[model samples]
Target: MPGFLLNLNSVVICSHGGQAKPTVPNPRVRVMGMPVTTLGPPYVVAGCANPPPPVNVGPCVIGNWVLAALRVKVMGLPVLLQDSQAICVPTGTPLTVVLTQMRVKGM
Candidate 1:
């Protein structure tokens, strides 16, 4: 299995807001490497930190370098690291990442 070094702050977790419950610092964060399972939910496994017995919850991270797979999505965006085959990224090129998730509230 391949692995990727990821910044935990860059990953997104879809879940309920803390207004319904007390905030927990650095909740257990996990990820399932992509090409996702056909017709089913993604299978989650340990991605970073020394995980403690797997508790599912909202978004949380202490901002550290953790290992995951390039297939995983970070912050609702694709990591776009590498391919299954060896490919070369052109040097000195400008790249732009466009985020499609926009929110307009509390106007």
Candidate 2:
């Protein structure tokens, strides 16, 4: 858990939305390297498959970067954010490093 919680909800006032034009990239906290036991099954919301593709798949839910980012950070550095759910990660603590560390420990 991080000491601070980041609110992704923002209003940029763009002429268009979607990952085009401004195309503000959503920084995805890498969970690809996390331990399998903790990663949990592919998160499925509103009956949609985990990480549903970008398409008009009817009204449904999808991955929440804010939440995922928090999870990744917490799993990587539980000590850093002892009493928090999520906050921006410290400089240089990338997801790859965290997953590598955990995997090494497991082996």
> Judged by TM-score, which candidate is best?
2
Candidate 2 TM-score to native = 0.18
Q: lDDT tens digits, residues 1-107, model 2?
A: 22222112211111111110111222343223322222222112232222323643232222212223234333453211112112111111111111122111111
Q: Candidate 1, residues 56-90: lDDT per residue as tens digits?
A: 32232221212224445434333322111111111
Residue pairs whose backbone atoms clash in candidate 1: 12-75
lDDT of model 2 at residue 12? 16
Q: Which stretches of candidate 2 lie over 4 Å from their true place?
A: 1-42, 47-57, 66-72, 77-107
**Segments in model 1 whose C-alpha atoms lie over 4 Å from true places:** 6-71, 80-86, 89-107
Which pairs clash in model 2?
none
Candidate lDDT scores, in order, read: 0.22, 0.22
